[model samples]
Target chain A: MTAISGWGRYPINDTEMIHPRTVDAARRATVQANPGIARGNGRAYGDAAVGVRQTIEMAHLNRMRAFDPRTGQLTVEAGLLLTDLIATFLPRGFFPYVVPGTSFITVGGAIAADVHGKNHHCQGGFGQYVENILLVLPTGETIGASREEHPDLFRATIGGMGLTGTILEATIRLRPIETGWIRQRTFVADDLDTTIGALECGDSATYSVAWIDCLARGARLGRSLIFLGEHAALHHLGERHVANRFPLRKPSMSMPVDAPSFVLNRWTAAAFNELYFRAGARKAASSTLVPTHPYFFPLDALGNWNRMYGRRGFVEHQSVLPIKNAQTTLAEMLDRIAKRGESAFLAVLKKLGAGSGSLSFPMPGYTLALDFPIERGLFSVLDELDELVVAAGGRLYLAKDARQSRATFEAGYSDLSFFSEVRRTVDPAGKLKSRLAERLLI
Target chain B: MAAAEKAVLILGGTSDIGRATALAFAQSQWTVRLAGRSLADLQREADDISVRTGRQVTAHPFDVLDTDSFTVFVNALPDLPDVVISVVGLLGEQPRAETDLDHAKEILRTNYEGPALILRVFAEQFLGRGYGSIVGVSSVAGDRGRGSNYFYGSAKAGFSAFLSGLRNRLAINSSIQVMTVKPGFVRTKMAEHRKLPPLITATPAEVGEAILGGLNRRRDVIYVRSIWFFVMLIIRLMPERIFKRLKL
Candidate 1:
């Protein structure tokens, strides 16, 4: 009765039902509907989250089913969110293996994407920590898959994007922590060269990230700010663990509503970027835990911040070029964005290590991702960026791009045929489909 | 208990968040289908999701602008999904929306009319079947309409309120769960070329975890990052005259 979305931020149609609640109920709903798509907190900026006729809401399927403190294993229902997991485990001296940019994603979603984080250089991705999963097949049959048990299904499922089956629950390994804080170091780079030099230096970090501004032209083309961190040792927090343990706090007020346009533009963005670049006064020292939320992901603190981009919405252009062509590849990409006069403020550069996931996006390359508010000529800008990515033998991160040509996608991934071959084993009917699927021609 | 070989749907698909959510489900071995309007882009997203998630992910033609076939779309799926996540959002031109009636209507329709209509159907099926969960990506924007983006924020406010009500409604008689998730700024393809404030900006994965937390506790409302609660609270409590005068 309340309807589906809070704000009509997305273009949605009527004539459909969006279901929300428990797991058994999800099973029952599956039995009745001809087909349905599972929904999490609707944060995905593209159509992968849309439901045509039947949409199942997993926001309430959140439940920590089981946890073994000794081994630091957690069994959570399909809809459990990552933020809640950290709130529960961090004080317990444990955490999820890999995390993405925001905390609004679900456990089912994380497993579905096999998300990677800052530490991915050493830890691989999130899938490595997943012990097993309880799955529901298309025939409405339920099964359990893991590294040892349904090996093929397990591997395919990690990055399959929910086409293989529905995830009922996830069993994952949690990490051990000393204090609820981190020891962090910051490095300021005068150019891209210094940033690259710093990454090659050492791995004595639990986390490392570089912030680059794609807008800087000429002399300071790829100027950067690098930060590295590790968890504070056991003696750091002393006895604060018991007192701060659940950190019971009220949920933040959601975005009251969408904002007016005209708030975001090149001029506004430039001024902000200028201040941001100057604000990162660098230093290295032991830091406070400060609740893993903002530290791990600083952007999650504000709500509906994207509304500033006006009504046309925005898009992020993230491309990872092989390390072999790092300088040339990035230079070209930057040239394209700059020439188009579409430079975003928050451009990041990460020197990737070996990526081990089946369909992982980050490889042994330099990954640069930036957000650009949509405007006239933006599509063409993306088109040009895509071309640059292809020429460098690099690929666009499909997870981030809502507009990608089929040809570009095919060219981006050389082994496109191999994934389809594996998909046939799980879903031969091609029944499970999404808006993203139709575009890619898969 | 084993998870059923599932079919999942994301309403308001075509968003970076929605696509990522679909990818999340797909990688978990769930057969995922991303339904959206632009056939060209959606298909590639689906294929990419398929490769990324390793589930037999596909794309089905969908038009959120068309309100006539929500039921048909749901009925057409090969199988039912265990859950549904709606990351559908439209932060249309706030200036245009505030000044132009049509733009305001578009905002309301995209966030409210469309999602409500589709979700109502989903609710009926989920309730009748006695199962399912609805996770709606409400926003921190919905907390309190501020000076900058109140139009979009109000719609999200309605959405968040609706989700809260849905959660309360499903609490008693149904196994269905409703989660309202609020995320701050996400650095996505759509948000390229913008100056995002540092303290509250989040990446896709951080939001992914917050959504996970809401689901874990079956919480009615989830703030992706805990700090957002304080940020919004201070903003909300401020007097309107003073609030309007502050420079964001």
Candidate 2:
């Protein structure tokens, strides 16, 4: 047994890890004495990928099975990393329809979390692009599930957190692109209403996101800069852009050690926020054409950036509310956070389109994500925020959740009973379980 | 038409190192044929490589213990392979083989007789064609016998000697090449239960790439991690008077 933790580096657990190189080996591992969960790159931010007893490291099972260039349909083993896909296909004028903030995640992890990206307003969640999934059930039987067949099990497994079974493989539809550059434009907002208004009016762009200054107060409350982008067409590219297309530059910088806890106090956070906001304001000029790496995955440039939160690590609170209550709910949460003198180092907000799947996190509204270091009274504050979110009919993203009450989870997801019914039918004895499932009473 | 794709034949295709080596060769545009005990066990890897690299990969039935079928196996291939790799090895229960004669014999045959016979068959074919490369996966355990697993070690030692002599004989014509790969503490299914030292352990992919590099350079002998070369040299040079007293 070895100690393993998710990307957040919190709640570490000693797990018996097995790396299966083939599908048959993975199936045999599921029937082992200890029940386990499938873990892919351990990027789910919490205990969702770490089981108490065992963890099947699916990285070795990565393999490409089939790909049709005409229709842009790709069949790949569930362990294939998104980074590998982009490195192999982006140069060939293809990209995943939806991609999360980090390319380190695997196909299985993406489906289990139903992760949404900056383009959620146009492409929806990652699960929306999946056409079919092959699952290895607890009974050691491999079955295919899709929208047309076994729809209930398919829906339940999309965001089921590996409680249903081990995802063996999946078929996803990739979107075609002329080049690997993004035409980007930035808009600065001084307050909450302006930020929300800018995001709502920027529907013409395919990809949209906002970086908020959670430490700002009074007239500067909810100060943010919204970025909108569309794929750069082939005709728009100049000689230099076309000559150096599809450059996948590796991260040049990384945090070698954990920073001291005192380094990220409210004063430091507020100063950084001021500098960022001013920089954005200065850049509000003619649109710029940026490479895909910096445009979509800005944080990825600094590997292990989470270590800056200190030894206690941090928790990401990401929640979505209906369009009608999104503005008020977000404002209330931000106001409460600021009043308590607590500020997050990074804050992101994005608009989402209609959600799919029974337990998918996205809905037709705005979602706000904030990262707060673990400290005294942090849980109580998050608990109060959870109540506010529940009252506004918003649910937390389970992928980023390390702590949330069972009652809150049950109350937030209205289709819990249906998901439970499908899960029970598929895994009656519950051979596949994770710590997060136990915490949420799934 | 473009020159016919060069081909590589991999024995024991289900082994972790074999599959990784096959994929590496396929990525280099080589048509791969994976042979193991059962086609079903090899089908997944063959299909995966075919799709990922757009290369032709096929599965065939081959049992290393069935020495009589070696000639037929080579004859049945669609096209003569430009390179052949033998990754057949078995680490049976060391403690059990210590007392059980049958278990010891099985280990000896799996590590020595079976692989040696198969390579001999391929060596003859390559001699007639006047071109080809033969890679035999040996082990550092063969350098000096240890009390822990001498039965398996002795068999590997015999295989290593056979490869050395084969290299000497085949290099006379300078058309066919024979290379011996010595891998130390690879992280494969066979080594899952063993507690390996972290500094010396190498992944199967690492070993696979080393094999390809060794073949391309036509080396007489290559160690996967390179550090194992010195580690084995010290062990082999140890005086027997003191070496026999130690339990390692």
Candidate 3:
């Protein structure tokens, strides 16, 4: 047994980990004495991907089963990462329809979380693009689940947090692109009202997101810089950019050691936010053409960026409020943080479209995600925020939640009973359970 | 006929290192044939390679312990391979092998007898055709038999000596070439549990690249990581009196 943790590096657990290379081996792993959870890249920021006793690392099972260039449909093993897919097909004019902030997550993990990207307002979550899935049950029975066959299982497995079973393979539809360049526009919003106005105006863009200055208070409350982007067409690219249609570069530098907690205080964060806002305002026409990597995943350029939060690690709290109440709920939450002198190092706000799955964490609204380093009484502050969010008819994303009460979770998601009923029927013995599942009574 | 597509046959193709070598050759436009006890397991790998590299890859059944079927297995191939690589090895439990005779015998048969006999069959065909190359995957453990894994080490020692003698016999009589490969601490399914130092350990893909490079250069003996050549020299030069008193 060895110690393993998710991306946040909090709540580490000692578990028996196995890497199975084939479907038969994966089936055998499901029948082990201890209940197992299939881990893909461990990018989920909490205990949802970590098991109590056993964790099955699915890196070795990555294989591309089939790819039809004409239809742009690809069948791949569950362990294949989005980064690998981009490297292989981006040059051939293909890209995933919906991609999360980071491209390091696995296909199975993406489906389990039903991850949404900047284009969520137009494309929807990752589950919407899934054609079908192959699952290996705890009883060692392999079944193919799709819209037509086992529709209930299909809905439960997507955004199911891997509680139903281990996902073996999946067939997903890929979007065709002319190039890997993104034409982007930046707008600086001085306060919450302006930020919300900018986001609403850019709802028709292919992709749109906002970087919020959570430390800003008074007249500058909820100040943010909104970025809007669309895939660059062949005719839109410059001569120099055409030569490198698909470009990928490894992280130029990395955090070799953990930083001191005191180094990331309110003073440093405020200065950084000021400089970032000013930099965005300086650009003429507030527009530029950038490679997909930097435009989509800025944090990925600095490897081990999480270590900057120090040894105690951090908790990423991402909550979504219905559009009707989003502006008020978000302003109240931001005011609470500023009043306490507690600042989030990174805060993101995005608009989400309609959702379909039972446990999917998206709606026709706005979602705010923030990262705060663990410290004394941090849980109490987060608990208070949860009450406000629940009252506003908002829900926390399971993929990023580390500490949330069962009552809060139940209040946020009204379909909890239906999800529980489906889970019990599929996994009656509770042979597949995660720490997050047990904590939330899912 | 498109130059009859040069091919290589891997004996233990289910192994990580063996699969990597098959992929390397297939990427270079070589037809690959993978042989192992279970054709079903091998077929999955074959299909994966075919999709990735768009090359001709086929899997066949061959039991290393079944000596009687060796000739039949080779004759059943669609075309005689231009190169044959022997990667079959068993690192059985050292403590169990030391106490149980059956475990010791299994280590010897898997590492030495099985691979040596299968290569002998291919060597005969190459000698008659006056062309082809044979590569044997030996280990640095064979250079000096340590008490921890001497059962597996001794079998590799025998395989290394066999390849050396075969090289000398074919040097003047025929163009058939024999090469011995000694690797130190390659990261694969076989060495997953071992606590190996990261700097000295090489990945299976690295070992595969070295093997292909060595075959292209036709070197008589090569080490996967060149540092292992000097490390083994120091071990071989130690006096018996000093070595016997200390544990390796």
Best candidate according to DockQ: 2
Candidate 2 Cα misplacement greater than 4 A, ranges: A1-5, A12-21, A28-36, A52-54, A249-256, B1-4, B193-202
- lDDT tens digits, residues B1-248, model 1? 24337766776456667766775665556677677877655665665455333367666676665779888988886665667777777888888886899989888877777776677778888988888878888888888777678888888888888888877788996789888888888876557668988777888766765665566587877777778889888988999988777866
Model 2 chain A, poorest ten-residue lDDT window?
A: A27-36
DockQ for each numbered candidate: 0.02, 0.53, 0.47
Q: Which scores higher on DockQ, 1 or 2? A: 2
Output the better candidate (1/2) by TM-score.
2
Ranked candidates (DockQ, high to low): 2, 3, 1
Candidate 3, residues B1-248: lDDT per residue as tens digits?
23237889999998988889988888778899999989877987787777667688999998998989999999999878899999889999999998899999999999999999999999999988879999999999899888889999999999999999999989996889899998789998888878998877889888788888998899999988888999999999999888887787
Off by over 4 Å in 3: A284-286, B1-4, B128-130, B173-175
Q: Candidate 2's residue-wise lDDT over B145-212, tens digit each?
A: 99998989999999999999999998785689999999899998899788999788999989889988
For model 1, what is the error of residue A180's alpha carbon versus the real structure, in angstroms, after optimal superposition? 1.5
lDDT of 3 by residue, A315-388 (tens): 99999999999999999999999888776888899999977677888888999998888889888999988998
Residue A188, model 3: Cα distance from true site in angstroms? 2.2
Q: Worst ten-residue run, lDDT, model 1 chain A? A: A1-10
